[model samples]
Target chain A: MQALNQILRRIPVWAVYLLGAIPAPWLFYQGLTGSLGVDPIEALEHRYGELALQLLIVVLAISPLRRFLGLNLIKFRRALGVLTFVYVSLHLLVWLILDVQVPSQIWADILKRPYISVGMAGFVLLLPLAVTSNNLSVRQLGPRWRSLQRLVYPAAVLGGLHYVMQAKGFQIEPLVYLSVIVGLLLLRVPFPSLLNRFRQVDSA
Target chain B: GVGLAGMARGAAAQEALEPNSWEEITSYNNYYEFGTRKEDPAKYAHTLVTEPWSVKIDGLVDKPGEYDFQDIMSEMTVEERIYRFRCVEAWSMVIPWNGFELADLLNMAGVQDGAKYVAFETAYRPDEMPGVQYPVLDWPYREGLRLDEAMHPLTIMATGIYDRPIPNQNGAPLRLVVPWKYGFKSIKSIVRVTVTDVEPPTSWNVAGPREYGFYSNVNPNVDHPRWSQATERPIGGGLFAKRIPTLMFNGYEQEVAGLYEGMDLAKNY
Candidate 1:
């Protein structure tokens, strides 16, 4: 575990960015070579959406990992966040350009479909976070930046809900993902005070 | 009665427009009774007991009884037909089906004068089909057709595909195959057939009336509210292959269009 931490510490943020960017071209190659099953467009769209969700989960885990395990991955969090936004954008683009080609129909879907509306809501919340990810915006916004970035919590919840609602029937995989997200959110609750209360009760 | 040799000759003679691979046809299915995934039925449907199967022919039929599957097969003459099977979800496949016309079966059952519709019920075996445990849909999936639609020459009671007995996943023993309507209208693994005067309630229409109408004829002009039906992806076509434009009545307009004469298809849809 110590050696693993040392290796993680030595890895540069740029390396994380490069690794994250690799899937994009690999997916494109899969598309070109007809390796993405019968419905390629749908496959590509699903892959991007899943990748984005997975990255968001990783981002949510970073803080808990740092606090409980002393694994500080703070430096790469920004890169991970940026990669999540990229994948989410690509997912949306695939739906827009490939799946639903009609402009009017696209607007109708965003307005009418509950899943699409929630997914769009998540994307909208992430937009400002993507824009203000730089050091300049952090310095300018000062203390308010942290409060604004707290929108990630709700955005992640919406993303999970979107996945659950889109399925035709009860599916366990999406439910598992939503449960994990909920668990991560629950872990964020301040638990040190509860631990102290338990310690006091034991002593008394 | 047509012999098995004649049936084989008929199957060999029919021209298939776009023959789907046997692997593709057998592997992918939408048998929600087994499960929702396209591949689930292929994995789970083998548990379904097909032998000793019987279909209850009741309601307005003169001869109402549980007819044995083997007896039904023995009485009828089988032939082959190549048809386009289009799904409501905008995907399609061309399959060569082997069976007899449903008209012959209905005639043999002696449809009473009052019968206006033919209702079908799929087998509800929870032990065999795990999906039946969930309320994904009302149990014992049901579908219906107007008496005329049921009697149409294109409508067949398919027992096999690709000149072989259809696997359980693809509705073994017996199933209805309505060539023009969306594939869901072709009820699978049927256990009952009722000829009734009233228009029967269909499973999908009952689940969501606004989304799935009683008449699910394939018309590209009428979009499915959630997705456009203008084009369809053919199963087994390479991932990057361009979607082909969907045809009206799935290219059977000439054969089935007259059945809907003087009716507003858009409203009925």
Candidate 2:
């Protein structure tokens, strides 16, 4: 764990950005080269979507880890969140531009498929969060900034639901990520201070 | 894996294998994977290993026997049958399946007169197949048909696909492939095929008896509980504009639809 942390610390933030950016180009190049074997666009979409979800899970884990484990890699959270948004945006763009060429059909698919509906909700909610990730926007928004960032929780749930629906035969891996986000949220909720006696005993 | 080599041997026994593009293969999946998702089979099937298999033929057969994987292959001729596979979920795939007639196998086994139905079961291993581990589906995948459906000329005891011994991803070793019905009717990785007098409850039908029926014939009119029954997306096409008009009995209505002339297909489905 220490080695991983040290390695992560050494890598420049741009390197993280570039690392996140690589899969898109690599998959696109595979598509261009016809290495995806068949239905390159759909394959590309699946790859991008999966990677985007993974990045989203990683981003959601940041604050929870800091609070529980006292690991303050706080500087990377905003960048990681933005990276997730970038991957998700690419995923949506690939679907819109390549998979469904017609605007009406894309609209129809989003409206018709319940899974797509939740996924679109996540995408739409992520837009404002991504836009506000910058320091200037955060400064402009001020007090409302924290509230705007709260959208991530719902966005995470929606994103997880999209994956759950996509899975066949009740895969629980996606649900675990959803649970982690829910657990983190639960940790923040105020409780009756029965812990005072326990803490006092510990200190004594 | 040993199965991969077995497949190579099987391919060598036949003519050059028909190597399908991933689009053609992935889109055209046997519907047992995710209820009715086109890509679900390929995705969930990563958990399946199609090697070290056998088929037990029991109950009301004159020559009741357990056929090992190797011997089952030596018995039949693998002919290419390119049929249109229509799913109840409103998707279709033109699969170039390579398998011989189930009739030949049954005749070899000498099925008795009292055998009224043929029940098929998949190998139920939750540890190996994560799909089985989940409560989303009932354990031990199952499907059944009236003895006549089993005897239908279109019914094939498929051991291979694309002129090759079936890939682990595509119900390898031994499986039933009934072209006329919805793809789920073709049970994958079959371990047992029992001849019985009573109509057996199939997996999906038992899961949602009202929605999925015993006779899940490919009827365009009988809509599933969730989706339209009228059309299907041909594998290899994009989400939009690629769905084609689903044929009645998957274009085998003339051959098999007569088997269910008066029965309410909607009720049975």
Candidate 3:
């Protein structure tokens, strides 16, 4: 674990950002070349959203990975968060510009559809976290920034819900995403303490 | 994606209706028996042995027998039809289908007096169909239509696309094509078509009763529980194509609206 951390430290945070940027453009190139199958727009949208969820899971795993396994790769969490936001933004743009082009329908969908509504809400929550995912904001806000970034918990859950809701039928993929997100969240909160709190609440 | 013919150009009004090329019509379809993905059907459906296929047409039919594919083709008068195929998943395709009307097929089978609905079932060969291994909406995918809807001139039992034998992925030897309804209602690779008194359970409706209804008529006014079915992105339009407003009864309202007279479409939906 110590050896792994030493190697991870040697790799600069910019490396994470650079590596993260690759998938988005690679996906775009695939879409542009007509390689992303019959419906490129839908494929691109799903890919971007899935990538965002994947990164979110990774970011969520960091703390537990360090606390439980002693594999500290904390320096790259911000980069992962920013990259997740980038994919999320790309997914939204594809839906807005390419998939659902009508201006009226955009607002209607976000307002009316629970899945879209939750997805938009998740995006909104991520907006501030993304903006503050920097060295300057980290220094200025200190402990408060950590609290603000914790908004990812609800955002991640919403993102998973959005995925599950949008799926046509009972698809295992989306449910797996939601379960992983919830599982990671449960890992973050101490299980025994949570159980005790729940018991106390029940007794009260 | 190769061999894609150029854009659907409206050259002449009749010739203008040539919306999709042979490649577009053959590839990119939802045959869940093959797999759920659009490409899955084209990839996996090849395993299906379409040669010497037969359909067991029973239930209320006087001539209830396993009709051989070749014999059915020889008996029926096949014709070309350029129809707009709309999926429940908000995607559209213009397919040049070659088949005879379902009405003619039903008449040949001799629709008995008690026949109220026609329930169609897709072939569920787990060995041929890798997707049937997974319980994705009950195996041997089923779909149904009202006796009137089934007998509609527009309701065709498509055997071919682009005047060629229908590819295994695109339902091969025989399939249903009710243009007025969503694509799922047009069950693919049909083996059994039963005419009965009761409204038989459809695959999608059976799976997600609230989301997918029995009468899945393309109505822009009626919204899906999850998303608005008001618009659909045409498949041939490529990536940059914007979604167009979904037409009522998929532009077959003139022909099919009379079928649902005095019935609340929204309630049924």
Candidate 4:
């Protein structure tokens, strides 16, 4: 674990940001070249949203990974969060400009459809976090920044819900995503003292 | 009113009438019995054995027997129809389907006075159709139409596309093509077609009553619970292409609107 942490420490956060962003343009090029399949726009949109969700899951895992395994990826979490936001923005752009097209219907869909509404709400929650994901804001806000960043918990939950509600039928993929998000969120909550006592009893 | 070829959807239709390539037509499909993804059918449908294809015609019809595909083809006239294929998922395409009017086959079978609905069922081979094993839908994908809608000259049992034998991915050998209705209404790889007095249960409608109604005729005014049906992104259009407003009854309103005179489209949708 010490060796792995040392290795992780040597890896530059900028490298993580650079490597994570390759998919954004590569996916677009694939769509442009007809490699994304028959419905390239849809494929592109889905891929970006999926990438965002997957990164969000990874972001959620960082704290747990450090606590349980002593493998700290704390340095890369901010970069990962920013990259996730970029993918989410690309997903929304593809839907708005490329897929949906009509200006009137754009607001209509975001407001009317439950999945879109939830996704939009999630994006709205993440706006301040992305804006304040800097060194100066971190120092200025201090403890308040910690509480504000906690908004990611609900934002990620909403992202999972959006995915769950969008599928045509009862799809297991989206349900699995939602379950993982909820499980990770549960992990962050401190277990009751009574439960800790029971655990000590079992060990004894 | 003998197909869109004669009925004519006008100049705007013509502007959009360059049929999507055979590759696009076959590759992108929604035959859920094969799988749920748009590309799933193309990937997995080749396993289906369409050689000894037969359709069981029964219910209120006079000739109620299992008819072989070749025998059925020998008795009918086939023609090419250019149609605007609209999916309930807000995608659209132009397809040139070659087949005969469904009315001809129903007529040959001899409809009884009691007949009110025409129900069709797709082949359900769990060994061949991998998607069926998971029960994504009630097996043997089902679809139905009002007797009048079935007899409409526009409705066809498409056998081929682009003058080539239809590929298994595109519901080869046999499939229904109701140009005005959402693509799912046109069930694929059909094996059973029954005529009855009662309205038969349709797979999608049975699955979600609130979302998909029995009458799934394309109506821009009626939005689906999940997405707007007001416009559709035409397939084959490049990434930046804008969505066009969806036509009422998929530009077949002039021909088939009389079929639902007193009924409310929003309620039915």
Tell me which of candidates 2 and 4 scores higher on TM-score: 4
Docking class of 4: medium
lDDT of 4 by residue, B138-197 (tens): 777899999999998889999999998889988888999999999999999899999999
Clashing pairs in 3: none
- Candidate 2 lDDT by residue in tens digits, B14-97: 233234454567544644443334456667666666666778988889988788877877888677665666666555666777
lDDT of 1 by residue, B121-213 (tens): 999999999888877788789999999999987889999999999889999889999978899999999999999999999988998787788
Local accuracy of candidate 1 as per-residue lDDT tens digits, A16-60: 999999998899679667576555677788899999999999999
Write one digit per residue (lDDT tens) for candidate 3, span B160-235: 8877888898898899999879898999888998999999998899889988999999888899887789899988
Distance from true location, Cα of A12 in model 3, Å: 1.6
DockQ, each predicted model? 0.32, 0.15, 0.56, 0.63
lDDT of each: 0.87, 0.73, 0.87, 0.91
TM-score of each: 0.82, 0.76, 0.92, 0.96
* Superior candidate under TM-score, 1 versus 2: 1
Give lDDT: candidate 4, residue A27: 96
DockQ of 2: 0.15
Among the numbered candidates, top DockQ falls to 4
Candidate that beats the other on DockQ, 1 or 2, i.e. the better one: 1
Highest TM-score model number: 4
Return model 1's CA RMSD, one decimal.
4.8
Collision count for each candidate, in order: 0, 3, 0, 0
Error of 3 at A13 (Å): 1.5
Query: Largest lDDT belongs to which candidate?
Result: 4
Give, for candidate 1 chain B, the lowest lDDT window spanning 10 residues. B7-16
Q: Alpha carbon lDDT of residue A187, candidate 3?
A: 90
